[model samples]
Target: MTQGRSIRLFLVDGAPNGLLTAEIMNWTGHVLTGPRSKLSELVQRPECGRTGIYFLVGTDPDGDLRPLVYIGESDDVATRLKQHNRPEEKGGKDFWEKVCLVTRKDQNLTKAHVKFLESLLIQNAGAMGRCKLSNGTAHEYIGLPESDRADMAFFMEQIRTVLPVLGLDFLRGIGRPSSNQQPEPFTPTQPETYPLAGAENPRLKMEVKKHNIVAFAQELDGEFVVLEGSLARGEWIDLKHNYRHLYKQLCDEGVLVDDGNGFKTFVRDYGFTSPSPAAAVVAGRAANGRFDWKIEATGQSYADWQDQQVSAAAAQSEEMEPT
Candidate 1:
């Protein structure tokens, strides 16, 4: 089981949407994030003058599944940020709408340290495929001492931990499930047990025989994950719905690629907020996920299986209540 973490978030302007700071317990790294409209306020903060890596986040004009990001490092982040905030005609970036700065509380990071961090961040972001990076080329920096490299690696892990809590999840990679695994059935007696723990969840399948589509998915940590190697329709057939856009985005990101047949294959496991979108992508049209996804072993509809769990939990609760 993963251990719990405590994170502290401070809203600078006393507004949820305004400038905010985040820090994890026992971590030396600090994070400050805010919208582009608050750029002046963010740069004025003392942390901006320290050496650090920063991220520029914005929507992708190409309608990709992921947000667009530009990673960079600077000895004086304020100066670099000011330059980026300039008019586009002045060689400034206009796409970014939010900024997140990662710096150290001890203020001991050097130029080489941040450069090395920037390089790794870019590489990892590309590997995660959760965002479209705007940077042209990633320059490797190997000047850091071995000890310093170890420290930076730990610092990078802290960054990864804190960013997701701050609503930045592009750094998180898709979790791969073990092959041919079947999740244990949810036991109603264990009310406190997490339903989506480990690889115990059932493998669900969505088959559209007419279109030759067959997709496999599982519920993990509350997200519906379409597994790698699942087959989907090559083209979106429903133009009336917005899920077609998501389908197109997945294709553009290479999450779905042509199999040389009439179908598209999942290059990697991808998680959706829920099963409906996953079903929509697989079927090439709008679909009701609860009815569409079925337990591969029992052929039970997802809705029926989920309803059974809920009913069992309720019965368990009633039995536990005072007679």
Candidate 2:
């Protein structure tokens, strides 16, 4: 009943000489690191790799101790345990921080003992999936895997089912949900425009088509922006990652007229199909986004607004920075 009391069990098997180890210890006591021997000599070699399970238990401050199980299917059980025992990676986690390495002291573990241990852990681990008992409790089998894929699925399902039975509450850990928080009002930033100035040139001719492919560039308060082409579903894509590359490529092709504000704008005459769905999208967004965007208000198109931004940015940069 002491807070320090806890039990840890391990099912060790690999190639030939496998063993089952279990121990009881205090929460603050030294935890076993890992098995001393290699995995090939531990569990008998199966067709592919090897598999085993580890179980640890410890009392909380209130002296309630329940076993926590970690299952594994691996080529090297000992090596994996060493990784978990280290304090840097998984070792830092609470469940792994106090691992009790287990080994059978009374008798060398046989195949029966390993199977029995696996069944015992599974029965206590969580809800039933499958199992078989052999030799009147000397051996047990749950058809669990010796691979990570099957073992992880089996154990996670068990833990999910058992944690609730242990009376552990996680949702209530933080403050309870509240309904009184007031919604914050949103204020729009500057406007959005298409075909920012220097984005498309007079020489660039676009054909009129049924599909609306409104391409535009704009300048606003000393900013340059450009967008053109059709949207899949009236949606816009953020190309920030490729902005620099796209801009440099465009400039190299003579699509960009100026570069300032740290990032360069597209510099070439990238053509787009005509008719322009962008006009409609920009018009719709104009209701929400910044910019005096309106069919009647600004008497200008989204493409024009974009051009204005670029022109303004170029003009301001020229005025401020001496050549």
Candidate 3:
């Protein structure tokens, strides 16, 4: 689990989607984020002149949810951004719509330091398989002094934490667990080990005994988690073509393996953005997880419990308000 930490974000233009800056407590790193339209305004900031690593972000022209991203390090961020902002005929990036850059607030980073950071970031962004990276060149590792390497590694962690807060999750992991995170197994008989607290983010289960479909899931840390070994229907009717492709991709990637029982079983715990998509994967058809995924003990559907929770919170909040 990610340890709790505080992050501070400032709106440079007083608009939520306009030029913005962010910082983490006890961290000496500074982050600058802004939309493509605000490029001129951002270049005026002092951060633009610093040595830093920058990312250019844009939606994929192919309509894939994964956006296109380019990572680069520059001794002068402002100058680099200016070049990218020029018209395509003048060699500017045409695909990027937003930009984020990271630099040291204490002004201690050297060209080597920023190069190391750039190489590492590019490698990770490509490894995540989340977005298409613009850099065609493979990263060339840079050697750093032992102490400096430790410091840079810590700086990268801070960057990882701050990027998600600014709405870029390309660095967020999927499919594989971090080195420190151990995988937990899911077993039907040991259901007690599951997340059990109902009325407060309860664990949910969906099973069609006749179809031999059984799955367990919960929402955690902004993700809908379906545990490992959960059974999924091998054949789904009326499944959208893209969702079908998604399942096949999961299978091809070995996240889901054939169970030899006409079903696909999760080889490891999988997290989905929401229950509906998770349920649809398990059912091999379109599914409403809110109505179909049920609390194992109470037999209440997730939709019912969610309604009750919302109503309760509203009533409690009303009681606390001053008359």
The predicted structure with the larger TM-score, 2 or 3, is 3
- Put down candidate 1 lDDT per residue, 1-323, tens digits, no spaces: 44799999999999999999999999889999999999989999999999999999999877675789999999999999999999889988888999999999999898999998888788777777678999977887888889998888778878877998888987754544555444332221211112343325789999999977899998875579898899999899999999998999899778899999989999878889899999999999999999999999999999999999889989999999998
TM-score of 3: 0.78
lDDT of every model, 2 decimals: 0.86, 0.32, 0.79
lDDT of 2 by residue, 189-277 (tens): 21111222222322121211333323343322122223332121122234343233333333344434333332223332222112232
lDDT of 1 at 257: 98
The residue-level lDDT of candidate 2 at 46 comes to: 29
lDDT of 3 by residue, 1-323 (tens): 33588899999879999998999999999999999999989988999999999999998776555679999999999999999988889999888999998988999999999888887777667655567788986556557887987787678878877998999978755433233445343211221122322245567799877897999877654677787889998866655545776676677667688898888899877668788888888988777888889987798998888888899999999999999
lDDT of 2: 0.32
- Model 3 whole-model lDDT (C-alpha atoms): 0.79
Which segments of model 1 are wrong by more than 4 Å?
179-200, 311-323
TM-score for candidate 2: 0.20
Better of 1 and 2 by lDDT: 1
TM-score of each: 0.89, 0.20, 0.78
